[model samples]
Target: MEKNNLYPVFLKTAQLEILIVGGGFVAEEKLHFLTKSSPDAQITLVAPLIREGTAEKAKAFQVHLVRASYHAGYLQGKHLVIACTDKPQVNEKIYQDCRLRNILVNVADNPPLCDFYMGGIVTKGHVKIAISTNGKSPTTAKRLRQFFEEILPEDISWMVENLNRFRKTLKGDFESKVHKMNEVTQHLITNKN
Candidate 1:
């Protein structure tokens, strides 16, 4: 059976430098979702001609914009990169450069050249969920994200905060504390009717 081998991880984008090489719709979409999830993320965008809308969005997130073509020099100090340029050759070159520098790179719409896929993310107060479709079906991941957004209660974060406070007040060994907490929260999944 086919399976997704991608390991999911949450990143602290604010602490890492990210670069996006493009100024088109794909680049805008990536920037939008990334900023929506991590408003403080430090990002730099390099494109010869940037759209007005793209420039406005970049300003909203304080993204550094360079009105020039992408080059290997832009990869300096960058931890992650997304290549979505209209020119396929340019995007491929970006991917190759990143590989040479041991940096993670994602070539938009090209799974074979990507080291990571930018999956759909849904965020509430302190709760966030990411959905991936193995880079096969992005539409499926979007649908799942919408479904989760609708089903999850708005106050889910409140419950999590309360649980955290309760956990801090517990007095017992590690195992005993875990057992007690599990018992306390068991009703969440158990049918009481």
Candidate 2:
């Protein structure tokens, strides 16, 4: 059997228990997206002093705020960890801890310590597109995301909902259901104009 590399898995971190080691703007930005996707996600923000904006947002969203510096123990049992602190040593320590625990870790703007890069995501209902360059150029990824965000129609959610209903109503084998779904999707896209 071939060994599987986790870097290639396009995972949905929506329900994951995530630990963010920072309370600055960077950490708040990350939290903003995470909470938007999954309001119920268990997020623990660890920092010595929480910025007002970060503290207020955390309080509003009921996020767990741990007022302390980065420690190896803080990484325990966390499915995903993010190091957004300005201190290079603290970020490095978190990365090493993640490696030891086999947990996924991303150090903000530090490609060397990042196990996986967080891409710009555009989600329309059930359909989602994640744009990434494997840390080559983040600006390019943001541009692509903006383009997709503009082009993707807002009515895509209606199409997805109808397709899901069709799937539920159909009683057939896997291949037949897939064929029917493709037909529905084609019809929806064509008539959407």
Candidate 3:
């Protein structure tokens, strides 16, 4: 039997060391996504020949572009790694290396091999929503992102600011503060007015 089990959580990518292996269209696409979503992500790309536009994007994003083929040593010190090379054998080697080292890795387009799936993310000020179709369909996740983008309130930033202000004024220990905040924002989760 197959499993669609995945645990979702947001990572602080700004401080993480990310490594990408590949330089073709797949690599370019992954890099583009990271550059926009994780602007501060420290990414090192290991590729012999980057596809067109990749250099420009890498320069713009300040990615450490390493002009070389894939090697196991590149995985050192990396918190998250993405394998998107054009050659299946190279990608498999990288994946196997990551597995041996017990590192979190994602092998693009191969759901069975990936440790994590990059879901469609919709970010608005203080509100960020991640949409996933259990790695079954990225298209569905993307459409849901568009749907959420339209429905999300524009004053969400204001709501967050006010909530923060309220929390600051409260006098309590950590647990009490959490309880008070949960009381205020519980409706958002339960969908009750």
Candidate 4:
């Protein structure tokens, strides 16, 4: 069997126990992503000294800020871990520790140690588009995301709501449902209006 790499997924982070092992700018950047991606994500930062805006962002996003250094024990209850300290050795150690326990981990800016890459995302209400370059170029992913964000209309959420309602009313097998949904949604693409 071929190993399927980089399976993209949107996680419900609200109930997850997430840990970040740093308090500097690197940690702040990671925090920005998490807070934006999953606003209610259960995040805990294990850093001795947080930067100025880190606390504000944490507060805005409801992150748990711990004024302490990273420790292996901190990894015990985390569903996902991000190692973002200035020390490469510390990040590598965190990655290894996560590996030993079969946990998903990402060492910031270190692709080799990352189990997953946080790709660019465009979201409008219930609709979301995730873009990835298989960890090659994040800039491209970011550009694509911006383009999508521009093209996708604000009222598109209305269509999404209608389609969801229609989907709930659908009663058929998988293929039949797909056919019906396609038939219903085809006009949105084909119509020049």
Name the lDDT value of residue 181 in candidate 3: 95
Q: Looking at model 4, which ten-residue stretch has the lowest summed lDDT?
A: 1-10
Per-residue CA lDDT of candidate 1, range 1-193, in tens? 9999999999999999999999989899999999999999999999999989999999999999999998899999999999999999999999999999999999999999999998999888899999999999999999999999999999999999999999999998999999999999999999978
* Model 3, total clashes: 0
Candidate ranking under lDDT, highest first, comes to: 1, 4, 3, 2
lDDT of each: 0.95, 0.83, 0.88, 0.88
Model 2, span 73-143: residue lDDT tens: 88877999999998988899889889999998999999889888877778777777877777878889889
Cα deviation at 158, candidate 2, in Å, is 0.8
Instruction: For each candidate in turn, give its C-alpha RMSD to the true structure in angstroms.
Output: 1.0, 4.1, 2.4, 2.7
Candidate 4 per-residue lDDT over residues 75-101, each given as its tens digit: 888999999999899899999999999
List runs of model 1 lying over 4 Å from the truth.
none
Clashing pairs in 4: none
Top lDDT prediction, candidate number: 1
Indicate the residue-level lDDT of 52 in model 2. Answer: 95
lDDT of 4 at 77: 85
Q: How does candidate 3 fare on TM-score?
A: 0.89
TM-score of 1: 0.97
Give per-residue lDDT, candidate 1, residue 177: 95
Using lDDT as the measure, name the better of candidate 2 and candidate 3: 3
Using all chains and alpha carbons, the TM-scores for the candidates as numbered come to: 0.97, 0.85, 0.89, 0.92
